[model samples]
Target chain A: MGDAGKMNTTHRRLILLLLALLCALTSGCRRDQDAGKVRIKFWTFPLWTGITGNEKDGTTEDWPRLKIKEFEKTHPNIKIDLEVVTWQGGMQKLDLSALSGTYPDICYLATANLPKYASQGILEPIDADMTPEEVADIYPNVLDCCKYQGKTYVWPWLCNALVLAINVDLFKERHIEYLIPKPPERGWTYDQFTEACKALTFDRGDGHGKVYGYALYGIPLSVEYQMLTLVLGFGGQVYNKEGTQFTLNSPESIRGFQFLMDLLDKYKVVPPGPAGMQGGQVGQMFANQEVAIESSTSGVLKQLKMSAAKGDFPYFNAAIVQPPHLPGYKPASMLSVGGYAIFKQTDARKRRAAIEFARFLTNEENCRALTVIGQFPARKSVGNIYPGDVDMGVVSRLIPISRVYFTAGAAELNPVINNIYQSIFTHAMTPAEALADAEKKANKILAQDALEKGLDAKGGKQ
Target chain B: MTGQDSTLKRIIKSRWAYFFVAPAMIHFLVFSVYPILSTVYLSFVRFNLQGNTWVGAQNYQVALSDSIFWKSLANTALYTMVVVPVGVGIALFLSSLIFPLKPSRQNFFKGAFYLPQVVSAVVISMIWLWMFDSAHGLLNYLLSTLHLAPISWLGESRTALPSLMFMAVAGGGGSAIILYLAAMGGIPDSLYEAAQIDGANRWIEFWKITLPLLKPTTLYLVVMGTIGSFQVFTSIYMMTRGGPNFATNTIVYRIYQTAFEFLKLGRASAMALILALIIIGISAIQFKWLGTEVEY
Candidate 1:
């Protein structure tokens, strides 16, 4: 070949290589800017996966993955990247992402976290995104959990209500099944509940007890919901109706705190050193038939059923009963609600897509389908999805009256209240002293938060 | 002008060397330097999702007055004091005991002690948590077999910190033992033989010849162990979560909770900077005291 011909051939090859390199570098950017397609990131904890069935159990796909698939099928113009953040460190990860401006477009928010995020302006309001009919389908109590300062921030998805669970096999073995109200209509009053616990408790005067009547979960950091339910059942409220004051030191609240202390210290119907046990430990104790009664969320029902199916719980079967109330007070259950909240995004189309995806995930059919994984749907229209299941039915019925433990500055209030309960349970402080100390500290935190946010003493944003 | 030209020419001559190190330099600059500077800056400001506002030294002032911060600091100090000396002592003892053994026996002992070092702190904490369970734990079960009453290891405030210390002192000190063994191997046999010719006892030999020779290794382990113990978070996070009325709360755990849980980034940064200073001070003091010139 001629020298000019060889030079031209080399030049052509170099140009082609440069072009390929450019394309490789810009391919991701090009896909991101593709016309008519909106990409949204949805981050959620593993609340649904591996709960019920997988390849091993021969059930359908994971619910969150399935919901994403279905949503994409209908909304072909949108793509969602589902990131399952493990529940253990999920909150810290989300908080760091939020601070770094790399937060997902849509994220899950719990009742305790909703107000904190909303107050920080990290979440966008979704009031205008929902249709009236869609809004009406959700029960008011559940829907209120997603609201802060008269603005909706999340699409209510599923809720878990706290209830009293009993070891039915143990009760029968002890012939104390009669103590449990029959026909599911009559509920246990304070006196009846206390008497039954005393009868069921058997201590052989040794260091160990073969069976304790109740497993009181006293892990301070995570026991707020359970302990608050007891306080509510005793006709006391942690906060006033306006959520502006810390009323934990009220006479009724003190009485409730005293009642718990009496249960642990005076009566000794509960296991020793209950302060050391978390929810999972208490569940394990119940499964092992060491504790006859446990106050837990509805999710425990599914856990118990799974254990029974696996033959791990062969010694006893579990049943759910209404949480007992004080003599003159009505029964109450503390509700834990999980839902989706959209982050603040500058792109209009992406925000719309995120909201629509959230709505689709929480829609009636999808919410009902999620029940297979053991979460009660937030929408009231599809009630009692677990038909013929007596325990779940009772939990479903109580959903209407359940109250959330969300209060302003709950992120700061929780530790303080938890410390008070820990003190009471550990016998470090009297109930009155603990209640007073908690009220003082919590009020100080509330005032500081209010001052920082320019809110009034009455908790109104200025 | 000529000197500047030569300097530029020298840079151009070694450009490939600079190019080779550019990636590492950039990574260190972006990750390490930037975070350190950012944390220092954030310590004087109140940061939230919205933005940051200057709060001056208020965060430090608040931390100084806060009882919880002091309590956590005290807990961390106590943990470091207990874990460092005991861990180093145990490692020294074990390494000495295994030094004269046959190769196979030495390997067996070393591997048995070093096996736990490979396990993650989270997993070890979980195993300890199960062992410390109040009612049905293996520790309590063993206690019951001996006709001893069960102790609430992690439940009561008096025992919670001690339980964590026990876990640290038991499963930890593995790497230190290996390091000590390596250092002991480097010691000259002539010194030991000379001491033996003088009829020096084994205990005197260990105290005089062996212990003095391992000074550098002990100093290194002491500094590292002190730093590690001061930053103890994973065990507390997985096991106690600073519970039972802040008995097991350490400085790192409290800082994490303040930053992420309460969103008090400014306060958390201040606490972190204070902890860093304290660690540096402690390390400096340790070097001054135990860091002797061993030129054998």
Candidate 2:
């Protein structure tokens, strides 16, 4: 009786063990099946990823992460990995990744960099993937920024227009409050702007007054677009109508360049040592109330307001106004557009997932969410999220007339212009001489770029 | 036949050792050797994300003709010339001063100096950037307190490279100091006692004994420092971006710009090769000068 009972118990134990192993094997196979899901990698800058305000308030879920979660919920077979890259050295990192064949499936491309990536054929044409309604939703002007050879390569997201940020307290202290444009569309002419700068600069005759009228950023590469804002405001266009030539030495551009030099050299309204300062330093000077006015983009409004709220400024009532225009020229601002583009992907399913994810990130609802973080939505339907926000309202009014600082050879042309501007700041060349030199160098670069891309002399794509 | 069989048996017995080293050897081959060989090949070709084409010495010709390349090389040479000797001298002086301290005091000074080495170069550059700001920087603030007009420490071309040099000399000698102190510690106390008996003073003993005895350490530090300073990219990138009319541009920084920003990988590779040769040549010269045999 004991032997029979023992045998039966041993057999039952073996059977149970076999069943457990079978279950484990089946679960492992299921895990492998889940791993087969299509995964897309997205790289973006910190601007699109909003600040993580108090974790307890649940503001930590930034728009990109939130959209990814919703996307995964609907498309159960797809997964997305988001990588946030800093603006500093971001382009270098992307270039290395592209060369090494390790680039993400999707990446954020600045409007100025779009041509470089597009011309190199590193970006896939997204026009076929975008629906007509989706294409129609984006502002026409912004959509134009994403096109190269009539093919859309990017899904345009949000944009920021360069504007004049004024310290109201300084204006009041200087008794130049009337110089602030009322409607902003009828901005102050160049003469009035110069007068305001002179009045705002306080020397105090004892080396004690540290305030300056303007915070000029002459650091190369980063501040070129800000410099271009002043150039465009004076009726100067960077490239001609066909985008074939650089007009940096034109009469209008020379006037603009001379005026900037005068602000630093002749009038001394801008702070000295601007050649070493970057965009952040200018923003900091404005925030610290050390400068009366600064030329900045719409993105700085949130920071100025935050600084005011934090009591970091002595008197921090900031106002936005359209950039000054010349007497006979129309008012204009430098429009900078940043958005997402799909990298060249060989897998059809993965490419579709990447494009879908990019669309989801820039759709109307998501863009509206992005607006709360101080980005101007690219869709006309969204409009101004904060109509009451004076700074944003001014930005909205300026967007219609603002001109983008992009050309076929923008990436190559930027450094040359920056070098010329720096030379002027260093007193190495007069504005006319610098502009003339820049025109020569820019044309050389454009010619080389055209030759490299197998384009004709007229700058048409091969 | 018996000897060969025993060697084969020994190798088989020690197979685990080879197995353990395989990962590291494979890593060195893949990351180091492959990249070096690829860079050599890329130096003679035009490369892009899509593909590469043979350009055959065209990049080298461009680099030789490029004025910016020569300026960057000169900047690098100047940086190395200034940073190596000054940094090494300061490290030696500090190490001599700290050598006589008690163990606890020595550790305290060592830790204080070595702290900068532990910090990232990017962070150091950023802190110095604020400190060198023209209007609000601490340096300018100090100048103002002394009734001196503020000098644009990093704005003007005259002071931009020097400001970077000052930063390099300040905290960059941490590792060198530690190395010198360690080398000094290894010196026998009997030599100092012998010199004292010979009526030699501290300065004479330092010159006749300490300086000569520390030649090997000095040589090592000089070679390493020259190599490090020759590739000064981070500080330039973070602080100046080789700006003020390329006043602070260095070989490595220019190579970085050419490769990444301009997407001229071929030219960047050529520049990198030139830099490596310069570093090697300078190192060989340092070895020839300071590498005399010192008998303990």
Candidate 3:
């Protein structure tokens, strides 16, 4: 009845109006959809972004925009929405997306992650629509990486092979040319590699003048990827034939691991404090000519070339060679396959569109783009993509012997591998002790994972 | 019957005030409260992307039996034990030294200490990475000058956790100093003046007047600092990554790895609940012990 009462009534009405406006504004902001057009959300990491067209253009969608535009010309009814995620923590992002039922229609996945994603039933099978001829074109080794339970879940794209890259100038300076592996020869034996390392390692009187034979990142993940070469070359297997048990503690594997430790402790040819170093640091040391040899991969090569172009890198003449193997054992290299996977979609049309786009992306014509990033096309028909380039020529030759470093349950095994290296480098455990501990922990985790998946301890169906 | 109004009538009477606060309350419930409740629910289930199955206390049982979990808890406890008290003491000491200075001088010191607080934790950890580098780090360089054996600050199990603690003690006092300074400003200067007039020396006056009055500020710092130390992940994630054989691993880092990396969301939730309960228990103990003496 009074002035204050009138003010209160008016304020309440205003607040109600504002609240209604807020609700309407939020609700109206749903993602825009074009009439009669199927929108497919595509997510990818910066794979193949080293190509000229894939460079950033002030948007996250740039790397794959050209390809999308080409695809859109033929498929008028389907629209592509692309989001490029970073390699770091991308798997977690994918996991979260899958959990929320908001995953992209298509995304890039690695072989390491394929097992987990495929087992979750979040991925659509790629083989369902593939022609027999199309399937046969892909390299069997790389293509097999995409399969789970006889169904292909990923469209094979590229094979990432890691090899030993030695500083040619350092070898020349040490007069160890004969020790380097030349063509027509398989890699040197462990004794030969050790001899070369001793020869190349030298100390200068200046404070900054020590050049070690080799320097490697001792972090667990890096060890699993880079140092696994030693394990494999020494005739060690990460898992038993049944994929049931950890076998890195076997005598052969222990010998391999001991050789790595000996390189640091006995030979003292590697720089100190490898336990604290990261992969990038060792790469930098190689570029800076502080170390003689490094375990180099296609990704590292891409980085090195980019740095050189930017004039930010200390340039060096490098040669690719096979990692040293034990006598009577074949030399081996680690390969990580990169590929595109289509997520399970409710709409049949959207699923078809996704498969078509995936096929187009991996076609022979577009496969050449992989060369820019130092990746080998997954299709054997694509063949010798590097052509005349000497370094890649060596890598192409090595691809036949390359093996997938990670298999099912890699997420569980990798951390254990990392810890074993850490324990050894920190002197907390000897090589044999560390490997035994790793086997124990990894087996428990793998067994638990297998049980959760309704499988036997050997990763077999019950 | 004479005093109480009907619920609808009471709500109508204060309808305008309630409307003004509705947005904030809704935001809190959606972002904070809902997630917490979800986590608690999830702690009792085995979460799958397809569906979550109820498995009460199994995740907790797994965590309790795991040796790494216990090690991580002990590491977190050790980190909190060293960092929280040391962090509070540094803040108190710095605040006491700066409180008597001119406003401009106080602001200078405050800004200097607060610089790390403003800089991203990732950037600070990167800088410390260089400082802690065993072969080329500044600390090793300093030791080399004195003809002492170089220490692997983050590469060795014994030194990794302590190195992190030192970093925390050094860089963690900025916000606490600001809080302590504000608390010190609120204390009537007459208390210090009366103590001085009664022939109490500076040290005696500080021990009797300044320190005791700062109890409330210290209590807040200790509780918050303890919580912060227990949740340490960035420095470990960025610098050590719980490496050197898990010497630097903490509860939060393990939880993050479980939920995100390994996709054991249910186990992560259970570990999180356990952590929450532990923090709550510790906070309660802190309040009981320190809250008894507060006067302001």
Top model by DockQ, which number?
2
RMSD value for candidate 2: 4.9
The TM-score, computed over Cα atoms with residue i paired to residue i, of candidate 3 is 0.91
Q: Which CAPRI tier for candidate 1? A: acceptable
Question: C-alpha displacement of B270 in model 1, angstroms?
Answer: 1.3
* Model 1: per-residue Cα lDDT over A1-462, one tens digit each: 999999999999999999999998699677766556899999987765443454465422265677788898899899888888877788879888988889999988886688767877889999898899888988888888888877899898898778888888777777887888554533577677777778778854565457878867656444367756666677777787667788878787787778777778878888778667666787777877778888887677677777788798674577778778876666878777888999998999999999999988787787776666667899878777888877777778788888866878888777678777677777778888988888887887777776666622223221
> Could you give candidate 3's per-residue lDDT for residues B1-296 as a string of tens digits?
63456777888999998999999999999999999999998888766666676767878987787677888999999999999998999899999999999999999999999889999999999999999987678998999899998887888888889999999999989999999999999988888788888999989988998888888889999999999999999998888777878888899988987787777788899999999999999999999988856564
| lDDT of candidate 2 over B1-296, digit per residue (tens) | 99999999998999999899999999999999999998899898766566666768878987786666898999989988999899999999999999999999999999999999999988999999999998878999999899999887878788899999999999888889899999998888999999999999999999998999999999999998889999899999888878777788899988987777677787889989988898888889889989999888
| Candidate structures ordered by TM-score, highest first | 3, 1, 2
- Candidate 3 scores an fnat of 0.40
- Candidate 1 local lDDT, residue B272: 94
lDDT of 3 by residue, A1-462 (tens): 899999999999999999999888776653333457788998998664434534554344554898898899898788998888887777768988987888999998887787777766789987768899988888777877788756799998888677888888888888888888876343778899889888888976678857888885655442357877876787888877556788878888888878888999999988777777776777777887788888877556666666787798666677777788777877878777878899988899999989999998888877888866778888889888876776777777777678755566666566678888788888889889998899888888778776666622223221
- DockQ (CA atoms), all models: 0.31, 0.36, 0.25
Candidate 3: give the clashing pairs. A220-A418
Candidate 2 vs candidate 3: the DockQ winner is 2
Each model's C-alpha lDDT? Answer: 0.82, 0.81, 0.82
> Per-residue error at A178 for model 1, in Å?
1.7
